[model samples]
Target chain A: MKNFHLDRRQLSVPYLIYLVLFVVMPLLVVLYYGFTDDDGNISFTNFIVFFTNSKTMGTLVYSLAIAVIVTVICLLLAYPVAYILAKGKYARKHSFLMIFVLPMWINFTLRITALKEILTMLEGNLAYHPFLNTVICMVYDFLPFMIMPLFNALTKLDSSIIEAGYDLGATFPQVLKSIILPLTVPGIISGITMVFLPAMTNYVVLDMVYNSTYIMGSLIGSYFSSYDWNNGSIISAILLMFIGFFAIFTERILNRGEKEEQRI
Target chain B: MEKTKTIIKMNNVRKSFDGKINVIENLSLDINEGEFVTLLGPSGCGKTTILRMIGGFDKPTEGEILLDGSDISMLAPNERPVNTVFQKYALFPHLNVYDNIAFGLKLKQLTKAEIDRKVSEVLELVDLEGFEKRSITTLSGGQQQRIAIARAVVNEPRVLLLDESLSALDYKMRKEMQLELKSMHKRLGITFIFVTHDQEEALTMSDKIVVLADGKVQQVGTPEEIYNEPANVFVADFIGESNIFNGVMTGKMKAAFAGTEFNCVDDYETGKKIEAVIRPEDVTVVKPGEGQLNGEVTSTDFKGTFYITFVQCGQYEMEVHCLENYRPGETVGLHVLPDNIHIIPYDTSINNFEGMIDGFVDGKGLFIVFRDFSMFVDAHRLYPDSSVSRGRLIGQDGEHIDYQGKKVMASFQPEDGDMSDDAKKGDIVGNIVSFYYIGDHYSYTIRTDNEIDYVVDDEDLWNYGDKVSVILPKKKMKYRLLEEQKQEVAD
Candidate 1:
């Protein structure tokens, strides 16, 4: 007689339940509070208050500006590093990758505290340059987030394609422009999303470096701490919507790029 | 014959990965323009290394590679007028078929119109006219292969190097691509240097075949010449199915093997040891006593085109391929015509001797005569109370004694001997005839006095034609008593 055995896929049931309870249920609770008032009455007042408050509106704009700058800076820095790590002297590349990833192993708050101390020593009274300090801190913390994806994409590239480019009379610059950069677009988009979405609302990095909480993430934290769950939930729901739109936008970019490549 | 221009010439090229071992030693070859020259060998035999050197993907450790009488050894791959279709058609996945074909041309800064025209022309040549807009991943392996060719050939390189390009395709696809590649070579009129391990691929498409083994070239000839007149035992065994035997040249154009004297076309020195190779298809079956050799059919296998019949003749098995099948255990006679017999000078790489054990002490050592030389040997484990070391017989009183003669058959592995360059301090003197670096050790064939050959596996690097002395260790040598000697001792 054949012995009964569990199908391998059935083992993932616990994980599926955990995801629904911890992830989907929390989003649903926020959505329920976002569209209701404290008296259990339907209302749009929380969203209107979030949109019209001058402090929140200015913080959102400043947060978006800083996130865009950090994402661009991280991309510009990571692309070359990832390329060198992927295609340079093969023996040294792995150790170099280890050096980049070693920082992530340390506790995140411990790293931020050390960076803040270093910045305070390098430049006296970092409070006056809060914007610059926060942007710098966010870029430093999330740089690996950018590098990890780009490095993965760059390393997985077929080396023969590069050789073929050279064989077809292409110079090094031409090969990179025409072949390497175009093929690594998915990594570029994913790296951008990982950096931009996190850097936008990560007030802990800003608060640690500048000793101030002036961003939308700080605004939402204050609301929740003061027992104004209604407004905090509204702000979080809007942020989720923005993050969802960004994900779809990047995905669309990837698909469109693929279509363009096929046209060629 | 009209003189053809030499396109590429590799002179005394040697390549080594580490400083200690050489992969290709003293290899030199020339490829004529517009000819399909194939570097054929088993894998790791440095065939791909030669192709890489020609394509400028690799540089040799020694010597020079010349193109059109100019040294191009130090030139980069792109700097040379050569292109390579890599083993698996490394097509760019990001680009379509047309863009891949036009990649090289666009770098030349050609006009867009000119690029499209060239791409379309090459696409049409490869019979992929409608595949211009198709993504590379969408095409089948064969279509991708054709696109790879079109991409390389569209550049109009002076030389094209194919590094086992058809190895990934199926059997039928490979066959189809072989003919297509041959026609492409003719139409392009460019020198093609192909590398493959398949002998049939070399025979089918190459105008000239260079057979290599262990990073050394064995022979260079046309397919017919290589098939019919193999240079050595390796080539004869590698090119086709053959029944090879140890033969002795008794007279001019006459050799004896398989208990019969056969007439051969090749003339050799009288009394010279040789090897004979006969293709399986060359043997004909006849009635008993009607042919040169009589044997019984042991087994017959139907192989679609023909039947392979295995016949056992006097302790030797010969395979015969013919249309007529015979039943198992049926008596049959086989005959090989004069032209079917091929004789090659013997090149032995192993040593075995039929000697006699002259005498042995019950608790001491033994003495044996091998090739008329009496030597003392340690007692084998089968016999107790007998011991010897370093050619000295151990006495019961712990002193050395001598045993002059014995009748025995002695054997020793070639690696168990010490070979010295100084000829004076030696047991056997010989010249190194051939040497092959078989990865771990050097296999050397040494021809001693009276045409006796001994193969030695050594770690030292010895040049060809070096005279050396070989001494076999007493502990490593093995011996057994002859039947007559045992009977005489018993009586």
Candidate 2:
């Protein structure tokens, strides 16, 4: 009995070992490399160089712009589909939602390559419209992420609250504005988080679609491939910080909308 | 007494989903201004459907829902001057208490100062004066109910619909809200239509009660009339604890039931079929041989102040409310007073089925074909006005009308039905689906092979699913014209 009791708590042993070795150690190594200079002296030389370079700064800003645009477009496209699916009188809603999610289950490289072909066929030359093609590919790849969270949150909404809105003399549009939009803010925020954070760093789509432009993910990759460990580690840390900021921002929006976990 | 204005009237409302079986049939009701009317029934009885139709959430399949003498059937929920407090008190979780209450008022585009005054005033009315800033999720269920009511009433709707609003709360909280809602109804002086399956809540809160079952209105009256003088078996069985018995009127002032005859106040004719209902509290317990009937106590359940003691005099058990405790097997007499005995006429709706008028033979009889059986009944039974002469039926207007291929409805009373154990003694063999003791005899439902169910009353008990033969009397069958007979009569 005593041995079994100990084993119950010891179940987390392998997970903790993997976390410390694979995750924590790599993060510590990145921190060590990021704080040191080429002569092995601890310094902020890499940060000063990355910040002072207008090219890298412009790439960061362009990546942020792409992420923002992709997120807004994904939200616009997913909200109505999720609402209609969740409004639910359709006999096979899960199968209907599956149709929306089926593309996400495909291999990422194959799906992006197919989208690149479709884009090339549509525009004649993908490099001629690198920004548009990348945005399209990024949205296509990350759409299911936005759709799943939104569909989940929307299906969980108490429809009676919407009826209560109509009962309170709210018209259809007014009910959507006053009741549904506010209630699904948490869903909208989660969709934004899933799309925005990934869109910033997913340079795979950029490379697959067009290589003329560089996002944060490609900048970090180029630095790492050149054996510039100090600059690559610094860029990774900055991207991680940006992700942390995005998470905190989404959390504020989610909390503001009174997430369902707060319900009794 | 001053006359009150009719605030809402439902005219022959019928609501069916998918154009199939109707959830609500041709139901008509009237609600006066300032009346607290409760639509009370079991689940799936269309009480909530009625509320939804009234609140403009659902449209009737065929009906005119009039609001203060104007048809509001075509109006949207927002366009209608009615509001509903939903069953779960559907408070918008994203909005604060103040914003939630001010929602409809803000839609009216009132000034901010005026909106504030109105919101706070309605909040005070529901006794949630200081809860304006409270988040809907943070407040308790009871507080949410108050705020929901406040939100709905702030708009000053002409009629307020509550679809089992208090049903979500705990027992004690439900009781408190019942009283608070009653006072709110009185203060607002607006028409309130509340729906609940809980009969006690309906009795306590409603000035009038509309008892419903199977999408049909059973009875509509004051709470006392509904409780004391139920219209039929459904209302009597649904309202409160009732010892209902299928019996007959022994005389002008007497009722015979429970294997005995007793004085009753209803002036039903002698030998007329009826039902007698006596409340548990109405039976006065007496010494053995002192009252009308003597019995031994079968069971005694202590209910706070009084014990509901069941006395078995014969096959039927009588429930009596007594302050003095009685042990099982103790002998006692039950005195049921004349005024206490509520005599309801036995409802006539029975085995009605769509049938075709097969033919009429010159000298024999009128042939009617129902499911799985064809029979010849008297011509006069179809309608007292018509006659079968020379192989053709004459209409009420004396025109020669072909009766074959015409549609009709064949009906018979339960009392006219009989059951036999031997197949040779009856027309059709069936299985007894269920049997419940009703004072003097067991009321049974028997399903035939063709899926036709016949409700028959018999003195002998039958087990469930027991095979029996039904004796459907030819003379007892009545037929009514279905469609073209009316048009012919009008022509």
Candidate 3:
């Protein structure tokens, strides 16, 4: 009874326990299996097999290319919608981001399947547009992720800054280049992170739409389903390492311009 | 000295938004080149709207805006040769000081070396020579304000618009910026259109000020002209501290106001109504029997260099700014020089009321009925039918005529109405619900028990919860018969 007060340290106990049970333990087990071989001997057999196999290496390169392409396309498509929705007049009457949000409320599989049916019916077959169909489904699934962050960023921007640019003799193109796009960098980075990182491994879109191409997620899935724990764990371990590096790498580049200066 | 040409002219410009009430009414103005102008008014007076129109951010709804004798109303803001320093010093948060100042210069065809030289030159002009590399967010508010100014001035536009740019700084910082901005205007020799609601700032910095109210230009003149010879009561009240009284001409170069008659310089028709404006600084304080009126000192406030002493005479409270100080309850006499008294002819904006002629009284007056009270007046004074005198409405054929329930429109100037502490002396009684002091006189709105209000201008101060009576004299009123309406609309 004397110690019944809920302090800040005590408040985080449940979160710490959840982290250990769900995140740390699974990561450790995967690492152990990924680094060791049969008979429980520690070895580099899984890494050697993964890196040496041309098919597996080729899948990684292919997945990277698809992720990059989808992210660029999604950004180019979502920016205009987000900017228009964030303006004062249009934002008051309707939250246009709900256009993306409503589709997201439906089950992901059903939405993707519906999109696949439309694309297949239009193109006559999914085989003819394996890369195109895969790219479309990936962008369709991740378009909402791109728009929400950009909208949030654009709305928080002070309209007076843009006006100041125009007042300072900047044309429309110059304002977009120097004032508007630079201000929304935080949202753009987050949108890219949310879209690109997940697009790299979303093999479900490929399997449902084309079934003719392979991505990192399907490669990991196939190896694990065949009871090949070492190879599957190695693939998962490589991906986890890649995500960890990519996040820090992106942050470093974003903050690179803000060098320390002597305060006057 | 040569007369500078007109740089900008707004011809019959009317601005409204989305079918709403107009923010700026039909306004025409001229801005001369190399002159510093200030659009001065209170909040929502369309001072900022005028600046926006000049900067090409807003377009006139019905008129042409000419820049240097050409129509530039449809040009974009970037295409116009004028720039604005927004109220909050809208500096780009991402850019450093040097880049922000050079933002405008880069839009032209200047080389990199020339842009650098011009940026440094303008930075020197704003006295922030070494702050070019500093980030905008790290600088103080006053510094950001300087950068915002530097950015616009670097472009060397024909005109510079400042939208309350110094209001964000502290009191001391704002004062310093005021002087700095004045000097900057001197060196640049450009047309500066500064917008501010602060009357003191306008008086201190502007060469000419255009006072605005109710979407209309109230007066436009140099600071001294606007202060000494205001066109109307609104200009007099808005520009400086002045005692505004509803005056009536008594004789040539003579008017009576604030319950006393005084000599003035301007001559109007005898019995012509006017507004007499006398600044507090022009009022001389003297001993009780030495001046035109005697009053008891009600209060004295010690300003830095002088004292503002308020004296309550018979009914008017006189404000005097003098070096001499007096204690409360002291008796003092206030006098104004004849030349110092500015007389402005009154406009016909008055309070109109509806009343009905009930009947006639025996040699006293005809009975008149109103919503709040009723009064008696002789019918011949208003409607001269020649036979309506002697308290009798005898027609020309010697037949007795009935004059009851006849509608008439009665109107009086707000100052013509008087108030009395005694309820029996007035035609109606009401409580003084609210009142505002228009520098010298108190404008009071009295609400009667029936929820009717009478707005009267009195010089005396009344305490809270005091019930007073309103007296509207028939001699000071004009009445018109509503014969063409065919039906009584007084009710």
**Highest-scoring model, TM-score:** 2
Weakest 10 consecutive residues, lDDT, candidate 3 chain A?
A: A255-264
lDDT of 1 at B175: 100
- Models ranked on DockQ: 2, 3, 1
Query: For model 2, how does the per-residue alpha-carbon lDDT over B376-429 read when each residue is reduced to its tens digit?
Result: 767776666887666677878988867778888877777788889998887778
How many angstroms is residue B413 displaced in model 1 relative to the true structure, after the best TM-score fit? 7.9
Interface Cα RMSD, each model: 4.0, 1.5, 4.2
For A1-264, candidate 1 gives per-residue lDDT tens digits of 999877867988898899999999999999889889998788999889778988788878887998999999999999999999998756778789888978999999998888888888988878878888888888888999999999988897877778777777777888889889988998899999989988888888877875475676887899899998888899999989999999999999888766644632
Best by lDDT: 2
Instruction: List fnat per candidate, in order.
Output: 0.59, 0.80, 0.74
TM-score of 3: 0.81
* DockQ (0 to 1) for model 3: 0.37
What CAPRI class is candidate 2? medium
What is candidate 1's TM-score for chain B alone?
0.74
Give the residue spans of candidate 2 off by over 4 A.
A1-12, A125-128, A252-264, B250-254, B287-290, B356-437, B440-491
- lDDT tens readout by residue for model 3, B1-491: 88879999999989988756778889999999988899998788899988988887788887888998999988888999998999988788878898888888877878999999998899899888988798887887888899999998999999999999988889999999999999999999989999999999999999999999757899999989888998987788777888877779999899998888999999999999887888999999988888888999999999999999998887677788999889999988888999999998976654566788887777666788878877777667665663754557776676676667888777776678899999998878999865656546687767777656677778899854579998876688877777656456765
Candidate 1: give the TM-score of chain A: 0.86
- Superposed on all Cα atoms, model 2 deviates from the true structure by an RMSD in Å of 5.5
**Separate DockQ for every predicted complex:** 0.35, 0.56, 0.37
Cα lDDT tens digits, model 1, B373-440, are 45655565323444555655565665654333444566677668778888767777898876654223
- How would you encode candidate 2's per-residue C-alpha lDDT over A128-221 as one tens digit per residue? 9988888888889888889988998899888888888888878889999878887788888888888998899889888887666888999989
